[model samples]
Structures are given as structure tokens and as C-alpha cells.
Target: MLEIEQFLHWQRAIGRSQNTVRSYARHLSQFYRWLAARGIVWDELDFRQLCDFVAVLTAGLPPLPSRCGGRAPGTVKAVSAAVREFYEFHRVEGRGPQDLVLTRNPSKLPRRAHSFLAHLEHRRPREVSRLARPDRQSAETVQVIDFETDFAKLLAAASTTRDRLLLSAQYDLGLRVGQALGLRHGDLNPMRRQVMIRRRDDNANGALSKQKTQFIVEAPRRFFDLYAAYLLGEIAHVDSDYVFVNLSRPPVGGPMTYSNAYQLIERIGAAAGIDDLNPHMLRHTHATALAKAGWTAAEIAARLGQSHSASADVYIHLASDDLAEKLRTTEHLVWREPQQYRLKGDGDGAR
Candidate 1:
């Protein structure tokens, strides 16, 4: 068996992230078990034997292994890396030869491709009508209105009207969970009908305007009205700063945590008969709504603070109704016959 201390030492020396090192250690330990099951010592196993072990690890079993089943080539590569690192450490320390760690090119292995198209079809099929299964998330139409209504319900159920405004801000502005929770009082501009999102790190305020970039989300008039009510109502000791507050009437704490936002969504979704409601779903609904309203993927990406619109492609599937309408419009433009007129030379000269 490989020495655990040496493996961890090598991982730390290589400057790997804590999460990554933990994952690598787990995969290598699993590899050790598979080797032992076949009565082979890891150090004594040849390169060909290692390949066989990998094949066995990936092959379909009756019940399938936990977390390891259906692992992609990338996962296989990760395991191989951990094994190689362990052997290499031994070799460099003079306990084994350098050749013991077989170095094979990972790119040569068969790659596993995840088809987003198939995922979309299975999750929300375009052929299915919305009315047939209104509860089912369908690609036939973007579910923006459903999201809006559910968000409204969440606000009403909130412990305070401020919480309600915060929920409204997320759906209305398409703010990410982090951005929504990090909002400050200065962020909201009622007259401008916009909010500014300042980025933070480590659940604490980092450098002001250092890692900070501002994003503007269109605040509906209702948001302004709600904010006014929240400020004027029972919330005593109201702080001039911080748009969102904790349960306390006077804002003793800063903005809400991201976890609180997630729990709020879960609670609200359960109340709205949408058990799977999530922040990203609201973002998806926003993207789908924009796409249907003739916004390009790039525009949607910019508004959502994404470096690329590739992630926004999932919402494109939700624009099936818009696509169908566009096709109907195209039919009239291209296939319809035009009225014919006889020229002067066809029958008689112009009078």
C-alpha cells in the first residue's frame, strides 16, 4: 500500500488546492483497493496490468460502484495522475526506479462527450405542449412569469418586507445569489431604477472597489414602492446603509449570506409548488425571457456577468415558441405567391 504521509507531502509540495488534493487522495485510495482485490501489490504491477485495472474500474458492474460509476475519461485521467504522483515520489526518493511510474499521454484515451442537446430534450422536450403538463418545465415557452409570481410569493412570506424586496431584486434584476445577498443601501437607486452589485470574498468585505465591479439591474417601479414601505414600516432602528438586512428590525448585521438566499429559494419554491426552485433557475428564466424578446446570447451574457454565453445556451432551448413564431413569419415572407401584372407588351401598348 502507498504511504499516506508521502502522498500528502507531495500534494502540498506541488501547491495543489485543498479540495483537489483531497479528491486525488480519495481516488488513489480506491485504486489501491481495486489492486488488492486482484491480489496484486501496486508497486509490483506492470504498466499493462495498470491499464487492465482501469478498464475494470470503469466497466459496468451489477449494482455499480458509488461515485465511480460512469466516470468519464477525465475522471480516469485524474486517478491516473494521482497514481503516477505517488509512484514518482517513491522513484525520486530512490525507493524505486523512474520507469515504475508509467507516463502515458492522456489525450490518447477515448474522450467522453456530454451532449447538452440531449440533456435539454430529456429535461424539457420541445414537442411537449405547456398546457399538457403545466407543472412540467417545458421548452415550448420561457417560464419567466412563473418565476416572477413565485418570487413575489417568497417576498410576501418573508419575515420582513425588506426580505421581500431582496427576493424581488433577484428575479427582477437577474442578480446572482452572491450579488443579491451582498447588496448595500447605496446600491439601490430608486430614481434611476437600478442597483449596483459590489463583489466580496471570504464572506467578508474585501478591498472596496478592488475586486469590485458594478452591474446594473433594472429595478421595476414595484421594487421602489416596496422599498419605501419597508423603510417606513415596523422595521425600527433601520440603518441608512445596507439594502438587505437580517431578521432584526434595526440592521445590526450586514447583508444576508448566500446560504440564506439558497434556503429562501428552497422554502419559497416548496411553498410555490416548485420543489426544485433555485437561483440559477431564475437566471435561466431571465435568459430565456431575454432571448424570446430578441436579445442575443452575448447581450444576455453581459447582463448576467458571464464571461461567455456558452452557459446561457440552455435557455435557448426554452425559446421554442419564439422559434415557431419566427418560422410562421418566414413562411409568408418566402413562400407566399405575389400578385402578377401584365406588361404593355403582353397585350396592348400603354394608352
Candidate 2:
């Protein structure tokens, strides 16, 4: 347990973001708890034990009713990576045996291998079959909503200007909830029609971008209008720099936490008759709109502030019907025959 704290501190020292460190801590804690339950000692941990743990995470072995079913493969991978890192740290400190092995391939040896035999050895970490696991997340489970109509319902259901703007940021700017809530007053630029997502260490509510990099995203004009209203009405007397603040009784001026943001969405969703609505769904809605509107993958990725197009691929897949429609239009324009050139047997086609 003490080593977990040390590992977290080391992660911070290496400049990992707070959210990442917290995730690592959580993963390691779960692994350690599982080990303890089985009366397994740390020093006795081996590759087989690690494999068993992975099975538990990927298959929900030794089923516990209170526990949710197996986690997604991506989550299982994260847990495995954390455990591997923990082992590496312990091995480096001479507190645990090496879990990885080194092997040499004589057939693929470099020309200089004879002079440097040690360099020929390649490090091979313990095996975990990533291919055998299920997808990190099931695309079919993603709930997409009718953006314009549902958004209007959300706006109508919002109790305050702040809540409305929160939804606007998520839906309009395609921001993750953390990115939206992390917004400070200065992050918004009405004149430039952009909102900056900057990395901050003091966000107690864990409002940080997944990429942990500062970037600006285009803001809807209406969102800026709401921002102006929120500043003057809801935030006028508040002293906090955070754009969103708690409106309910105690700690009214405090920064809005993630729970507060989620509850607001859930309440509005119920009123709007949209089941299981979430901030990420709004983001997906934005991405889907972009893909259907003929935006390039790179353009959509840039707008979403993603480092790569892979995350944007899901939206592209969701817009398959739109893509098919475009393809049909293209086919008609390039390959459709003139009406005057119909076959004699095709009576309906010969007009």
C-alpha cells in the first residue's frame, strides 16, 4: 500500500496528469485488494498470478453478484499495464523478482552481434493475449439523440443559465464533460468565437482534458450569448474564477463538481424524455453531425481537439447512412444512363 503512494508520487514527478495518476492508483488498489482476498503475498506474485488477475478483470471469474460484470478490454489492459509498472518498480528496488525475461534470436542477429552479445538479447515482457478480449467499449451501446430537438428540450428543462451553457458547450463545442467544466472565465473568447481548454492542476472536481494539452475550439455564437447572460446574471456576484458554480444552498459560490454536472444532465434528460442521456452522448451527437455534413475526418478531429482521427472514427461509422446517400448521388451523376437510351424490352424505362 505504501508502495502505491510511492508509485503515484513517482508518476507525478514524471509529469503525469492528476487524472492519470488517480487512475493508476485506482487500478493498482483494485489489483492489490484482489491479491489480499486470495491470501496471496506480494513476494510470491508471478506471471501466472498476473494472468489470473487479468482473467478476473476480463471474464469476471469467481463471480461476485455485487460486482459489475467483466470490464472492457481497454480497462483490463490499463489494469495490466499498471500492475506491470508496479512490478518493474519493485524489481528495480530489489524487492521483487523480475517478471520479464530476455531472449536472443540467433537467426536475426545483427552483424555486430559477435562483438556485443549482450546487445542481441531482446526484452520480452510476460504475455497477455490482448486479442482474446472484448472491445474496450461497445459502439452499439452508444445512445445517440436527435440533437436539435433534444437540445431544445434540455434548454427548456434547465433551471439556470449556467446549466444551459454547460449543455451548450458539450453539444455545440463537442467537449467532454471534464473539458467543459474545466473552463475558467478567461478560457472563453467572445471576440474570437473560441474557447480554450487549458490544463490545470487545481481543478478539485477532476475537470481535465484526456489529452492534457491546451487547445482552442470554435464556440457557437449562441453559446457565447448564453455565456454573456450567465456572467451578468448567475455569476455577477460570485468571486470564483470557474465559469460554472454551485447554485444550490450551501457552497453556492463553489466550483461545480463532476457529480453536479452529471445530476444536471440526468435531471434534464428525464424531463426531456431522453433516457440515459449523458454529456458524452452530446459530444457524439456533435461528431455525428459533423460527419454527416461532409466534414473531413481531420476537420472533425481538429474541432473535437483530438490528437488523432481514431476517436472520430466511431462518429464516421455512425454516419454510414449519410455516406451511403452521398455515394448514391455520386453514382447517379457519373454512371446513370440517359432516359432516351433504354432497352426495347424495358417498357417502363423507355418512356
The number of the candidate with the highest TM-score is 2
| lDDT string, candidate 1, 106-184, tens digits | 3454444657686675543233211122233333323453545666666665666766676666666777665666667
Question: Which residue pairs in model 2 clash with each other?
Answer: none
Pairs clashing within candidate 1: 185-242, 185-243
- Residue runs of model 1 more than 4 Å from their true location after superposition: 1-145, 149-152, 155-159, 201-212, 234-236, 248-252, 307-311, 314-319, 334-351
lDDT per model vs. reference: 0.62, 0.77
Residue-level lDDT of model 2, residues 2-34, one tens digit each, is 778877888888877655787788788788878
Residue 73 of model 2 has an lDDT of 53
Score every model by TM-score: 0.55, 0.72
Query: On a 0 to 1 TM-score scale, where does candidate 1 land against the true structure?
Result: 0.55
Worst 10 residues of 1 by lDDT: 125-134
Clashes, model 2: 0
Candidate 1 displacement at residue 180 in angstroms: 1.0
Location of the lowest summed lDDT over 10 successive residues in candidate 2: 130-139
